[model samples]
Structures are given as C-alpha cells and as structure tokens.
Target: MRELITKYKPVIKFIVLFLGAYLLLSVAYGGYLKVSSHYGYTPDFITDLVANQSSWLINAAGYKAQVIPHDAKPQMKLIVDGNYLANIIEGCNAMSIIVLFIAFVIAFAQKLKKTVLFILGGSLLIYIVNIVRIAILAIALYKYPEHQSILHSVVFPGIIYGMVFLLWMLWIKMIKKSAT
Candidate 1:
C-alpha cells in the first residue's frame, strides 16, 4: 500500500487538489446565490452582467437587442429584433465553468505568481468568451430558430468547453517549458 501510494503520489495530489478547489469554489458560489436571493438580486450580479454584455454585443451587430428581467424566475429574457429569443439564466453566466477551469489549473499549478496570474487571465478570457458566445447564440437563434436544439445543446457548449480545454493544454505546455 505504501509503495503504491508513493508511486502515484502526483496523481493522488492532483485529484485531491482538483476536487478540493472545485468543491470549495462551488460552495462559495452557492452561498453567493443564496445571499443574492436573500437581498433581492433576482438574477444575481454576474448573470445580469453577462446578459447585459451579450445584449450590447447583439445590438452592436445591428440587431435591436435588449434584456429584461423574467417575470417568473431569476433570469433575464433576451430579446433581439423584437423576437423573444432566449433566457439568460445563472448557469449562462459561466462562473461555474470558470470555477472548473480554475480548479484544473490549480491542480497542475507551477508557481504562486504564475498560477495566480494564469487564473486571473484565464478567468477573464472565459468570461469574455461566454459573453460573446451568448451574443452569437442569440443572433444565431434569431436567424435560424429551427436549429435551436443543436445550437444550444451541442455547438455552443462545444465552443466554450473547447476553449477551456485549449487553455488547459496551453497551461501544461507552458509549465513544462518553464520547468525545462
């Protein structure tokens, strides 16, 4: 048992770090949600920010885009060109994705300064990409309502997750190069 543990120490360490970070961040987020709801921030600040940015981008693309609070839920209703397109929910905010990204990056962390910088930069990149993704998705939905299922379920998810995967790979390569 000791030999096996010694042999796989790095793997074990990675797993523990990843799970610990993920759980801690997720709990913090849940607390934020609870507090926001308690204080009357219906959609929460991050989700609202994402919705507003997405709407701004869609408007910049020549569409009359706007976001309004949902009447029955904690979400924003995205309207483009007077068409009811999609709902911007808390999940759409991408904080969860950022949390996942941060967890993975921390698992493979190199140095304190580099790790913190990467987390900050990577989180910002993910947030911006999510806003753009939401904008493009809204525009695509407005243009091709028929393909809504595929666009929402598969394609857009692939884009964001794919971007995170690429970032992870880049981080690994960067650390390896620095170590050498």
Candidate 2:
C-alpha cells in the first residue's frame, strides 16, 4: 500500500487539492447566497438584464412573460403567458462551471504561470456563456413553452458542462504544446 501510494503521489495530491478547492468554493458560494438573501444585497444586474430580455422574448413569441421576485426567497420566477415556466435562482445555473473551474485551477497548481491566464480567460468565457445560456433559455421557453422542463433541466446543464469540458481540453492542449 505504501509503495502504491508513493508511485501515484502526484495523482493523489491533484485529486485532494481539486476536491478541497471545489468544496471550499461551493461552501463559500452557498454562504454568499444565504447572506445576500438575508441582507437583500443580491446584485440588481442580472435581475435587470433578465427583465429586459424577458420583454423581448415575450414580444417575439407573442406571449406575455412576467419575471417577478419570489416573496419568500431571493429568486426570480418566470411566468409565461400566465403559466409558471421556470425560476432563476442565484447560484443555480452556474454552480457546475464555478466548481469545475476551481477544480481545474487546483489540478493545475504547479503550472500556475502558464495556466493562470487560461483559467481567467476560461472563467470569462464561462460567464459570457452563462449569460447567453440564460438568454437562449428565455427564448427557448418563449418558442417552445411545452419543452421548458427538458431544456431547463437537461439541455442547459449539458451546454454549460460541455463548455467546461471544452475549456479543459483546450488547457490540456496548451500544456502539451508548452511541454513540446
């Protein structure tokens, strides 16, 4: 057992660091949400952006869309043509991307000089993709309200995860090239 552990020490360290960082980020994010809710400091930027985009989506679909705040929670509920379609909660959609990035950073800790830029760029891309995802989801809900469940639960998650996978692949390619 000791011999085996010594042989794969690097791999074990990578896994431990990745898991620790990911867990810490998740906990911090959850705490942020809780405190933000309690103090009513949730950023107005997303809410306003969604509201404006909802109007456009509603007009395009010829259906009335309403985005209203939940009374008991710090979340936005999207109502489409008088029916509840989806709820936009803080840290709900981008949790995977955030966690995955933290994991990736930890996994690349030794190569920080080469990887930090990649990490930052990837994070920015993820953020932009998230906004696009939300917008596309809004449009999707407007176009095919009946398919909201699949789109919201499955398709969107796949998109974000797919993007994260692509980012990781890109990182690997870059690291390989650097080694060569």
Candidate 3:
C-alpha cells in the first residue's frame, strides 16, 4: 500500500486537491441556496431573471421577445414574436457551470490575485455566453424547430463547454508559465 501510494503520489495529490476544493465550494453554494430559499428567492426567480435577460438580448437583436412566468413550475417561457420558442429553467441560468468553473480554477490553485481575477472573469464570460446561447437558440428554434434536439443537446452545450475547455487550457498554460 505504501509503495503504491508513493508511486502515484502526484496523481493522488491532484485528485485530493480537486475533490477537496470542489466539495468545499459546492457546500458553500448549497448554503447560499438555502439562504436564498429562506429569503424567498425561488428557483423560478433565477429562471425568470435569466429568461428576461435573454429576452432583452433577443429583442436587442431585432426580435420581439418576452418572458412568461410560471407559478407551479420553476420555469419561464421565452416568447419570440408571439411564438413560444423555449422554456428557461434554473439550469439555464449557468450558475452550476460557473460553480464548476470556479471549482476547477480553485483546484488549479494559482496565485491569490490570479485565481480571484480568473474566477471573476471566467464567470462573466460564462454568463455572457449563456445569454448569447439562449438568444441564438431562441432564434434558431424559431427558424428551424425541426432540429430542436441537435441544437439544444449538441450545438449549444458544445459552445458553452467548449469555451470552458478553452479557458481551462489557457489557465493551465498560465499555471505552467508561473511555475517555470
């Protein structure tokens, strides 16, 4: 057992750091969720906010968009030009992705200033991309409702995750440079 541990020490260290940081951040997020829930900030609040924000972007892009609130479900309707194109849910808000991004960045454990700045910048990028993704998806669904599954499941998710992958790569390069 000791020999095996010594042989894979670096891998073990990485796993420990990543899991520890992820768990800590996730627990803090859970606490935040609880506090928000206690204060009446339901999942619908986040969904509605993202839907309205996405609606603004869609409208600004020359389409008439509006958000329809739901009482029973934590979802909002994204209406574009009198057509219901998509339902905005809590998952659509990009908070979980931001949390994942922060956890990864924290795991990498850059300098204090660099880590904080990267998290802030990366979170903003993810949020903006999410809004744009929602807007573009709304437009695409309006034009070609036939390809709904591919667009929603493949293309949109690819864009967001692809961006995060790129960010992670860039962070790795930064870490390498700082280390050397």
Candidate 4:
C-alpha cells in the first residue's frame, strides 16, 4: 500500500487539488447565484452580462439584435432581426467552464505569480470566446433554424471546449519548460 501510494503520489495530489478547487469555486458561484436571485436579478448578473455582450456583438456585425429577460424563466431571450433566436441561460455564461479551467490549472500549478496570472487571463479569454460563440451561434441559428440541433449541440460546444483543451495543452507546456 505504501509503495503504491508513493508511486502515485503526484496523481493523487493532482486529483485532490483539482476536486477541492472545483468544489470550492462551485459553491462560491452557487452562493453568488442565490444572492443575485434574492436581489432581483432574473437571469443572474453574469448570464445577463453575457447575453447583453452577445447581443452587442451580433448587432455590431450588422444584425439587429437584442436580449430581454425571459418572462417564463431565469434566462434571457435573444432576438436577432426581430426573430426569437435562443435563450441565454446561466449555463451559457461560461463561468462553469472557467471554474473547470481554474481547477485543472490549480492541479498542475507552478509558480504562484504565473499560476494566478494564467488563471485570470485564461478565464477572461474563455469568457470572451463564449460571448462570441453565443453571438455567432445566434446568427447561425437565425440564418439556418433547421440546423439548430447540430449548431447548438455540437459545433458551438466543440469550439469552446476545443479552445479550453488548447489552453490546457499550452499550460502544460509552460509548466514543463519552467521545470527544465
């Protein structure tokens, strides 16, 4: 048992740290959602921000776009060119992806300054990409409503997660280079 533990010590450490960070951040985010709801934020501030930013990007691309709070749920209704495109939910905010990214980075963390900076920069990048993804998705959905399933379920998610995977690979390379 001791020999096995020693052999897998790094793996065990990574798993523990990753899970801990994920849980802590998730709980904090949940608290924020609860507080935001109590304070009368219908779709929560982050989701609202993402929705509005996505709308702005869409409009900037020469499409008429707007986001409004959904009357039936805690989501924002995204409208493009006077057509109801989609609902921007809390899950669409990218905070969850940022939380997962942070947790993974923490597990393989190196220098304190580098780790903190990477986390901040990576989170911002993910948020920005997510907003752009939403805007592009809205446009795509507006243009080809028949392909909604494929666009939303596969292509857009692949784009976001693919970027995240690249970020993780880059972080690992940085860690390896610093260690050498």
Candidate 5:
C-alpha cells in the first residue's frame, strides 16, 4: 500500500486539486444563478437594455431598427431594419462564463502569471468575443433561420472550442519559449 501510494502521489495530488477547484467554482456559480433567478436578473437585462436602446446600436451601425417583444418566446426579441436588410434577434445576452473559466484554468495549469493585468486582458478579449458571437448568431438566425439548430449546437460550440484550442496552443508555445 505504501509503495502504491508513493507511485501515484503526484497524480493523486493533481486530481485532488483540480476537483477541489472545480467544485468550488461550481458551487459559487450555482449560488450566483440562484440569486440571479430569484431577483429576475440575468442576461435578459442586457437584452432589455438593448431592445429599449435600439436606436443607439442600430443607428450607430447605420441601420433603422424596431424592437418588439415576441409573445411566443420567453426571451427578449427584436426586429431590426437597415438600409437593405431586416433581422430578428432573440435570446440571452450574457457572456457564457464557462468558456472563460476553462480558458483561465488552462492558463493557470500552464503556470501563466496570475497578474491582474493578464487576467483583465484575457477577460476583456473573451467578453468582446462573446458579444460578437451573440450579434453574429442573431444575424445568422435572421438570415438562415432554417439552420438555427445546426449553427447553435455545432458551429457555435466549435467556435468557442476553437478559441480554447488556440489558447492551449499559445500556452504550449509559451512553455517551449521559456524552456530555451
């Protein structure tokens, strides 16, 4: 038993630490969801604000817009009309933190500096990408509603996973550079 324990100590330590962190984060997120749901506050807030301030976003993009709630859906819905196109936008507007968390964990595992600046920069980029993704998805839904399921289930996940892969690749490159 002692020999077996010694042989797997490092692996056991890694698993314990990873599981501990994962559990902590999961609990924290669950609390956040509970509070948000209880207060009726969520990404829906962003959708509401966007719908209410439709002109700012649309006019800035040089598009005429009209946003109205769709009775059938439990989310914010919008209709935008531009110079030559029209679109329907519906869904939550909050960035998915799961992807960001995964990225952070990957970086941490690679021993990247946990400096505030580094975290902030990475978080900002992730948030920006999420916004772009939501907007693009809205446009895609409007233009090709028939393919919504494929885009949502496959393409969107692929994009986020691709970002994760790129981040991992960057970590590998950094590791190689440091070793020299």
Candidate 6:
C-alpha cells in the first residue's frame, strides 16, 4: 500500500485537494442558498428576474414583449408581440450552472486574489449570457415553435455550457501562464 501510494503521490494529492475544495465551496454555496431563500430569494425570484430581463431585451429588439406570471408554480409566461412564446422556469435561471462553474474554479484554484477575481468576473459573464440566451430563446420559440425541442434541449443548453467551458479553459490557461 505504501509503495502504491508513493508511486501516485502527485495524483493522490490532486484528488484530495480537488475533492476538499469542491466539498467546502459547495457547502458554502448551500449555506448561501439557504440565506437567500430566507430573504425571499427563492427559485421564483431568480426565474422571475430572468424572465423580466428577457422581456426587456426582446422589447429592445423591436418586439413587444411582456412577462406574466402563470397561474401555477414559479414560472412566467413570455409574451412576444402579444403571442405566448413559452414559460420561464427556475431551471432556466442558470444558478445551477454558476454553482458548477464556481465548483470547478475552486477545484483548480490559483492565487487567492486571482481566483476570487476570476470567480466574480466569470459569474457575471455567466449571468449576462444566460439573460441573453433566454431572450434569444424566447424569440426563437415565438418564431419557430416547432423547433422547441431542438432549441431548448440542444441549442440553448449548448450555448450556456459552451460559454462555461470556454471560461474554464481560459482560466486554466491564465493560471498556467502565471505559473499558478
């Protein structure tokens, strides 16, 4: 056992460090979620905000858009040009994506200041992209409702996850260049 451990010391060290960071940061994020919920920042709050912003953006693009709450749960109907496009839900808000991004960044952390700054910038970028994605998706669904499955399941998910992947790659490159 000692001999095997010695042979894979660096790999073992990385595993331990990455797992530790993931656990710690995830716990912290869970705590934040609890506090945010206590202050009324539930999934509804996030999805509603996304829906409103998406409506504004769609309107800015020369379409009359509005967000109206559904009679059911935490969802908002996206109305474009007075046509019901789709309903925005909590899963569409992208908080879970941001959480995943934070976890990966923490696992491969660099200097304290750089890592902190990177997380802030990355989170903001993710948030912005998500809003844009939602707006564009609403427009697409309005125009091409037949493509709903392809758009939501393939295109939109690809865009958000692609952006996150790019950000992670850039972070890795930056830290490597800095010898971190």
Q: Candidates' TM-scores?
A: 0.99, 0.78, 0.90, 0.99, 0.64, 0.85
lDDT of 2 at 62: 68
Backbone clashes for every candidate come to 0, 0, 0, 0, 0, 0
Q: What does the lDDT come to for candidate 6?
A: 0.85
**Per-residue lDDT of candidate 5, residues 96-129 (tens digit):** 4543455345434544463344445555665555
Q: State in Å the error of residue 91, model 1.
A: 0.6
| Model 5, backbone clash pairs (residues 3+ apart or across chains), number | 0
**How well is each residue in 24-49 modelled by candidate 6, as lDDT tens digits?**
76687667656765765434577778
Runs in model 1 lying further than 4 Å from the true structure: none
What value does the lDDT take at residue 135 in candidate 3? 95
* Per-residue accuracy of model 1 over 1-180 as CA lDDT, tens digit each: 999999999999999999999999999999999999887766998899899999999999999999999998999999999999999999999999999999999999988999999999999999999999999999999999999999999999999999999999999999999989
Off by over 4 Å in 6: 3-43
Question: What's the CA error at residue 123 for candidate 3, in Å?
Answer: 1.0
For each candidate, what is the lDDT?
0.96, 0.71, 0.86, 0.96, 0.54, 0.85
* Better-scoring candidate (lDDT), 2 or 3: 3
Model 2 alpha-carbon drift over 4 Å, by segment: 42-66, 79-84
What is the per-residue lDDT of model 3 for residues 1-180, given as tens digits with 9 covering 90 to 100?
Answer: 999999999778778877887788778877876676676554545656778889999999999999876566657878899998878887898888888888788778768999999999999999999999999999999999999999999999999999999999999999999899
Model 6 C-alpha RMSD to native = 2.6
- Per-residue CA lDDT of candidate 2, range 1-180, in tens? 999999999889989888888888888776765665566643333444545464455656566777777777666777776767667775554655766885776686647666667767787788667767776787787679889789988998899889888888877777678779
Clash pairs detected, candidate 1: none
Error (Å) of candidate 4 at residue 139 is: 0.5
